[model samples]
Target chain A: MKAIGSFKGEPITDSDSLVDVEVPTPDLAEHDVLVEVKAVSVNPVDTKLRAGAPSQKEPLILGFDAVGIVVKTGSNTTKFSKGDRVWYSGTTKRPGSNEAYQAVDERLVAKAPRSLTDEAAAAMPLTSITAYELLFEKMGANFGQLANPGKTLLIVNGAGGVGSVLSQLAKWAGFTVIATASPANFDWLRANGVDQPIDYHDDLETQVQGLGHHFVDAAVILYDVPSYYDAVTKLVAPGGHIGAIVGTQAKLNMEQLKSKSLSLDWEYMFAKGDFDFRMETQGEALRQIAQLVDNNFVHTTLSRTIDSGLNAKNLREAHQVVEEGHVVGKVVVSGPFNGQVNE
Target chain B: MKAIGSFKGEPITDSDSLVDVEVPTPDLAEHDVLVEVKAVSVNPVDTKLRAGAPSQKEPLILGFDAVGIVVKTGSNTTKFSKGDRVWYSGTTKRPGSNEAYQAVDERLVAKAPRSLTDEAAAAMPLTSITAYELLFEKMGANFGQLANPGKTLLIVNGAGGVGSVLSQLAKWAGFTVIATASPANFDWLRANGVDQPIDYHDDLETQVQGLGHHFVDAAVILYDVPSYYDAVTKLVAPGGHIGAIVGTQAKLNMEQLKSKSLSLDWEYMFAKGDFDFRMETQGEALRQIAQLVDNNFVHTTLSRTIDSGLNAKNLREAHQVVEEGHVVGKVVVSGPFNGQVNE
Candidate 1:
């Protein structure tokens, strides 16, 4: 099977950053599904791993978000069959979906949205799973029931992929969404169901206060850890919830949250996948997410798509595009050598 | 009205640290109650105020936990009548309850427990208010519902005034309580209803893990911030909640909470009184707590009581006891006289 992997940290611009190699496939367990990868999206985790993959005996496969078809199913796998379209964010500790044929636990895979294209569906899994878990699972949003109708959620860095989807989902769950985006994306954010889109460049505390809301019921941070920590802390109401997706190096004086009795939480969506806990819930969440997309309640964040066959050159270019840091949504490498997009 | 106050920060050993001074009677508002203070408990807050009290135009009166009788009630006050026995933790911004007569908002006052003596009642208000809010209000422990029966709560520093009361309340609320205390206080901690009293002198994580509670549902921390932060991060269950009453000058790396999706909260119970939020709830909680005490579901932690007359010398001695930090539970100063423990 053809795979894209790295042995050690390297700059994305270097030729050896991500290499195309052949790796032998392993025997499948009773709960595994072998997927023939058709399309995959590059996320920040891809770049992070590319630059930080540990030096080990085996090469580290790099992609997490992929849309593919079940080519083989284990005897115990009942949810999927051969030729079933699926989308998933695979586990971090195992071989990722960068390979042409990747064997994964059936529990992590979900039926892809039939109404959307493979590229669009590929972009949804990792970010959507993270946003969904952070809002509904960890923060106790309760998607099965209507969230507080007038409750406000402040989404920091609202134009990013996860924040974009989270805004729509929070709105879908009945919350009045307040998102922070750049000046250029204000109209785009409001168009995508955000009730109010504030400029991330301004003083967020002042802006939130000026909105006549003394504090937001909850806040989700998608980017800008050090700069936005205080702003989020100041904006949350008494006993309000705050979840940060990214990791930080410094200790953040949690005492800041004491006055309001604010709850500080961290959401790393891959933990359950890595630790093997209720892994089937990921598939269930993805299935529900697909329905939401099909019903037009949520939209994909595919900014652009390229076709160059699943190889090293195509992967490097995709990494370069994402590394530029101004992606409107997502960039996907798809197709079996489509002539123009590849050229 | 005669009161103990200080115009500036000074050592408790200094004769002028807390002086008896006569000030004009406070004017009563529509919902205010004029109480003749009968007894007062000296908490860390009193010492804190004596050292950190703001230099104001008028002298800053000190003391928070107080038990008294309502001498007068203003118009629109319906909760209590003249001669009603009450206890309260005074508002942070207002003149405190350590005086011959103190005017307090009726919402901050609750009927004292009929079964408790004045000293015992005074020892409860501040600690009870803090513990109740930390458990029910901050961490959302449902005292009204037995939803998470047999759930574990790790209370750090459980032999202190607030911890002693909190351990019993957690037990009453159907949680299996694990408390951390010094070796000397182990039996006392167990006697206070803690199922397990681990020594906080060693690694708290290992000690708790040895007891078979690898992770806890919630935690209430009273002291030792730097040592406990890492242990709390490790011992808190995934999606568990932690609340603390201590202040920290050092920054905390909140990313530690990301993997398990833990919640880190700080419970400043005075916030409600300081910010004037749901003030009536404090009185209501105190009233319910009084009932719990009357029913013997809880007990006061008045370790030592001084019939110290309302004067500078006696108040200074009470402050000294709290400052020494060896006193268990509460040290209260009571009665009225010409600057002596006995009238």
Candidate 2:
């Protein structure tokens, strides 16, 4: 089997940062399904794990979002069968989707939207899963039946992968969306269902107040969280929520959140998969997302596609684009594995 | 009107820490009610404000929980009429309940429990409001009709004012309550509906794990939050909630909460009255609490009562007891104002 991975953490600029290798096929667990990966998206998690990977004897493959076909299933698998097309943002605790054929838990697999291409579908799973859990699970927002008409949500980094999908989900829930991005990406924000896009370089509190909202009902920081924590605490109304996806080693001034009775929701989608806590919900969330897509309630966020295939070169380019930190939606590497083994 | 208050922040041991003062009655707002305070409770908030009081010329009266008779009602008040017995944990933004006559928002007042004594009812309001909000509003625990069987709640400082009531509420919600307290207070914890009470002096993680639970479903820090942050973080299960009532100025290592995707819920019940976010909810919460009390679903946490009345001497003694931080439940002062004005 062909695989692209790293033995040690290195800068994306290095040629060996993401090199091709040949490995034996993985043995399936009872709940596993063997997927022939068709398309995979490069996300911040991919870049983060790649750059900070521990020095290990075995290569650490890193890709979470994938649109693939089920080639085989373990004896106990139930939801997926051989030849069924599936989509998932698999767990990083085990080997991920950056392989020719990968084994994943059936509980985390879902049917991809029939209305979109593999590359377009690949761009959404990881971000869509993250956005859904953060909004519905962590922040406690209603997704379908009831509408949050007067509710407002402020999305920091509204042009990034998660933000691009999160703002759309908030709009679907009938929330007045206030997002932050560069001036050039304001149109991109609006296209993604952002009601108002304020420049991140400007004062967020003043900008939100200028929009006639005293405080946002909810705020989610998809970008650098530590730097934006204080600014966000000030803009969220008392008894509101402030959610974050990024982890920070630095200690945050948690006192600022106490006065207003704010809840700091940390959404790490991988937690459920790694800890075996409600892993089935990931599949359910993806199914709901697919329904929304097929019905035109939401659209795919694939902005760029590497049509040359999922080679080491194309994967590195995708990683570099995501690492630059200004992507409007998502970048995907499509086609079959064409990486020539370095050996 | 007569009151017992502090001129500035001082050690509770000082004779002048709490002194008698005479002041004019406050002007009532459109929704304000003038109450004849019958009983008042001494909580951590009262002592905290006294210990950290700013340099102000006007004496700052510090008491939140009170059982009183509505002596007068404002023009727009609808919830309460003159002569109604009321119970309320008023806001710290205005003059508190330490005076003979105090003006409070009618929306923040509720009918006191018909079965309990004035002193007994006084011990509940402030702590009840805080605990109710922490469990139901912040942590999203099901109350009333739903019984959260098999769910577990860990309460730090179980023998204190908030912890005593919080454990009872958790028990009523069908949660197995694991509480932390001094070895001397274990019996008290049991009396207050704590399923298990561990010593705070020992390793909390090992103790909680020893009880056959790898993690608690929900955790609340009623004691010092900053010191207990990491230990509590480790004990909470993935996707669980960590609720805090105490405010922390020190920075907290938030990364510990990221891997589990936990939520840090800071419950400041006064935020509603302080910021005017949802003043009506306070009254509603108290109403539900009163029903629970009258129905014997829960009992009052008042363990000690100063029958010497709400004079400067009795008030100082109550403040000293709370400041020491080892009381079994709540310490309250009952009877009319007997403070001899310093003038």
Candidate 3:
């Protein structure tokens, strides 16, 4: 099987940063489903892993989001069968979805949205799962339930991949969505379901307050938590929740939340897969997200797609575009494997 | 009205630390219930407030937990009448319950347990509400539901005020309760529904693992967070919750919880009163707790009662006992107001 991988933690500018390699096909575990990956998306996790991950003896495949067709299944697999089209953000502890053929836990795999293409489907799993979990699990929003009609959500970096989907999900869950994005992406943010799009460069507290909202019922930060910590703390209403995906370099002053009875939660989408805790919920979430996407409640956040096909060269280019940090939404490498085959 | 209060932050040993004074009777708000306090409990909050609260022109009355008879009611009050027996952990924002009379919001007060004395019922509201919210609201435990039979909880300082009630609440909610305290308090902990009581001075991880649990579903720290953080993090199961009442002075290394996707929540019982967010829920929780107490599912954590009554000297002595920090459970002041009446 041919895969795009990196052996050393190096900048994307280095030719060896991500290169094509032939590796043996992965063996299936009892709950595994072998997927012939058709498309994969590049995320901040890929760039971060490529730049700072310890050098491994074997090259580390670094894509978490993929859309694929099931090629084989383990003897004990129950949810999926061969020939099924699936989408998932696979585990971080195992080899990722950047390879031609990868074995993923059946519990994390879900049928892709029938209304979307493989590239569009691939763009969603990671960010959609992240957004779903961030809203429902971490922040205590009811799953697909409109129980909180007047509630408000403040999404930081609302034009990004996770935020684009998150804005839609928040709106679906009955939150009046307020988001922060660059002026260039304001229209896109509004189109994605944000009721108000404030420029991230402006004073966030002032901007949020200007909308006649004293504080938001919940706040989700998709980017640097430390830089947005004070703003989030100030913007979150009493008994509100603040969730983040990224880890902070410095220690957080947790006492700031004590007075407001605010809750601070970290939503790492890979935690379930990494710890083997409630992995089935990931599949359930993806299934629900696919339904929403098919129903047109959520649109694909695939802003850029490399239609030339999946190869080390194209994946590297996708990684470069993601590394630049100005991409509006997701960047995916689509179509069948074009690299040299090993088996 | 006669009240025991402090004009300056001073040691309990100081003569004027908590002195008897005459203050004007409180004017009731539309939703206020004026209670003739019969008994009040001294918690760590009282001692802390006495030691460092800023001096006020009028002395600050610092008791939060109280059981009293409603003497008067405001026009808009619906929950209580003029002759009802009520118990509440009143707000910190107003003059607390350490006086002859207190005007508290009707929404924050609930009927006292029918089976217990005023002193016994008084010992519960603060700790009970704290425990209830920490378990249910902050840590995601289902309120009044036995939804988690196999789940386990680790209660740090199980013999303390909040911990004593929390252990029972966790047990009632179907969690297998594990707690840490001195060996002397182990029997008390067991009586309070702790399934396994480990010595706090010994190795906590080793003690917990010896009980055949590698991790707990949840952990609550009634004392210092930073001191128990590492142990709590290691002992918490994947996707578990860790809650605390006390704030840390130093910055916390929150990244330690990232791998397991654990949440760290701070439970401040006064938050509802301070921020005016969902004060009704406090009353609802108290009403539920009172029913639990009356039904014998939970018991008052009152270990000591100052029968000498509510006065400056007895309150100061109670404050001294709390400041010493070795008491097994709550210390409370019972009986009539002995100071000179203002009216």
Query: Which candidate tops TM-score?
Result: 3
Write the residue-wise lDDT of candidate 1 on B82-173 in tens digits: 99999998787888977788889999889999999999999999999889888877676777534459689999999998999998788888
Screening candidate 2 with a backbone cut-off below 3 angstroms (N, C-alpha, C), the clashing residue pairs are none
- Say which docking band candidate 3 falls in: medium
TM-score of chain B of 3: 0.98
Model 3: CA > 4 A from native: A54-57, A339-343, B339-343
Deviation (Å) of A322 in candidate 2: 1.5
lDDT of 3 by residue, A15-87 (tens): 8898888889999999999999999999999998888978788989989999999989998999987799999
Candidate 2 colliding pairs, count: 0
Candidate 1 is scored at a TM of: 0.89
Candidate 3, residue A165: lDDT: 96
* Every model's TM-score: 0.89, 0.96, 0.97
Candidate 2 TM-score, C-alpha based: 0.96
Clashing residue pairs in all predictions, respectively, total: 3, 0, 0
Give the per-residue lDDT of model 3 (tens digit) for B70-188. Answer: 99999899989878999999898899999999999989999999999998998899999989988888888877656678899999899999999999998899999999999998999
Task: At residue B188, give the lDDT of candidate 2.
Answer: 90
Residue B185 in model 1: lDDT: 93
Error of 1 at B86 (Å): 3.3
- Indicate the worst ten consecutive residues by lDDT in candidate 1 chain A: A334-343
